[model samples]
Target: MKFPVKNELLKRLFAAQGEPVSGQDIADEFGLSRTAIWKYIKELEEEGYEIGSMRKKGYYLIKAPDLVNAANISTYLETERYGRHIHYFSTCPTTQTIAHEEAQGGAADGTLIISEEQTAGKGRLARPWTSNAGRGIWMSLIIRPRLAPQQAPQLTLVAAVAIVRAIEDVAEIQPVIKWPNDILLNGKKVTGILTELQADPDRVKAIILGIGLNANQESEDFPDELQSIATSLKIEKGEHIDRAKLVAKILHYLEHYTALYIEKGFAPIKLLWESYATITGKRITARMVNETVEGTALGISSEGMLELKLDDGTVRGIYSADIEIKN
Candidate 1:
């Protein structure tokens, strides 16, 4: 069966909101026969959805499988626009690549590209990211915000604050933002945010924000190198989390804060980002593309740059760099 028909059928069932959708209605909507609807229902059942049918009422969703597709994710979505259009893949090279292509092709403002596993996932500086199968949240969001090319970088801070709030809402854990783009838990990395832009010199077009979250991996899931530094939500929370629910929460907050940043400014986002900031006030070493600076973290500037107070009493605002805590 075609995936669009199946996905649309699932969406109709979900939209029914527990009420049974008539088979004839579905058939007419899709211009298919009743038998075709029944076959699609069977396929959904085989895929782990427990659908129920009445005599004349047709079919209603009794249970949804633990999947990250649009059907399962829509149940938890609360936003008006974000995540309404999603591209789900069982396996893909990277959501970032797909998101970029979609953005260039004029995809919707909140179109999301999500995958169950990323074959060639990447992080900041094009580093390889581990995207374990059936675990973790590998997704990229395409947002077309009303901002200039220079102000676009502040969106990264906006997204970081949203992710922290989402973590608090879903996992009930206190995750902190390690300056720039890493979200840390208990001093270990749990999530990484990579923000890419598609814009002209004077106008802003779109921002492809790639977020990779370690959701349900055990201790052995990480490579030897990451074992000591990386951790997952299941490991930290001592249980598995519903990835779909978390994704929905993240989208909700993203939509809220993104609007907030665009309307009010970066002041509110900076305050929230600083509250969960881990590197602020700590001595750290920042390695940029050219020079390295060791300084005391001095919170983020109005432009979302990391303000580092140096030994010579100079406060240098770092625009881009990989930072390490220096105790």
Candidate 2:
């Protein structure tokens, strides 16, 4: 679903610089009534834009607001398809839920559901994700890649690489990917990626990639329980961060990696993922739903399974587990 081009009046105002664009000119160009143009200006004002009005010269654009809304993100978008359709909300229950619903309703391949706050945020295995309002990025991308259901798990790894690259580009922080989909900085969780799929055993339908990055929040912003294990970019960098720029960088890298995965297969992405992963070659224990398997991390298999060298000589591939480093 594309965010419609209803801001033509605002665009005209921007292109005119400080010069005024008359209501009659906009009305003639867009075939809209003067009353319609007034409505657009009112909407823009509500979004934090300042427009100066004169007696006869029409409307002049004064200042643009710094919002992470659709208009702001569109100004910095470089992707051809991904993130072209953004559903921006100041607060929502969850972006993942919105993305899934839109995907089922025939949304495009690169629809982005972004929310400033998520009251019911989700983590891995239904755990609660701490998504403070206006402090971090709580967004989900709806991707309809042409991969099989078996290859679905690899997308999480793909998202991890893109997120890390975005962080390095903006925050200048070196983040490590803890197998599957957790990003760590200074041994604390800084970002989280949750990949959920709606597909059968054969073909893929949609992959909802949920990413939560702690950007401008302080240590005290997080709850007491999360203060020790969670951190934000601002906390580490000791400065304020621009969330909109970071979001743009993330979408850029995400689109690049997703396209590479589609055309060149997972070989190239696997190499990039391994460079950022820290669990490999370390002694770790995989905590499963039923049993805990402890072994050395032997890296991932060709199909993206975590290969663990057990106490025995045999090596095993783990599908789902919580991996914790032992030594």
Q: Which candidate number has the best lDDT? A: 1
TM-score of 2: 0.87
Candidate 1 RMSD computed on C-alpha atoms after optimal superposition onto the true structure: 3.1
Q: Provide the lDDT at 287 for model 2.
A: 93
lDDT of 1 by residue, 164-250 (tens): 999999999999999899999988899999999999998889999999999999989999999999999999999889999999999
Worst lDDT 10-window in candidate 1: 1-10
Error of 2 at 247 (Å): 1.9
Which pairs clash in the backbone of model 1?
none
Q: Model 2: residues >4 Å from true position, as ranges?
A: 1-41, 50-66
* Candidate 1 ranges beyond 4 A from true positions: 1-40, 52-63
For candidate 2, write residues 166-251 as lDDT tens digits. 89998898999999889998888999999999997889999999999998888889899988899988988888777877888899
Candidate 1 displacement at residue 222 in angstroms = 0.6
Go through the candidates in order and give each one's C-alpha lDDT.
0.91, 0.87
Q: For every model shown, what is its TM-score relative to the native structure?
A: 0.89, 0.87
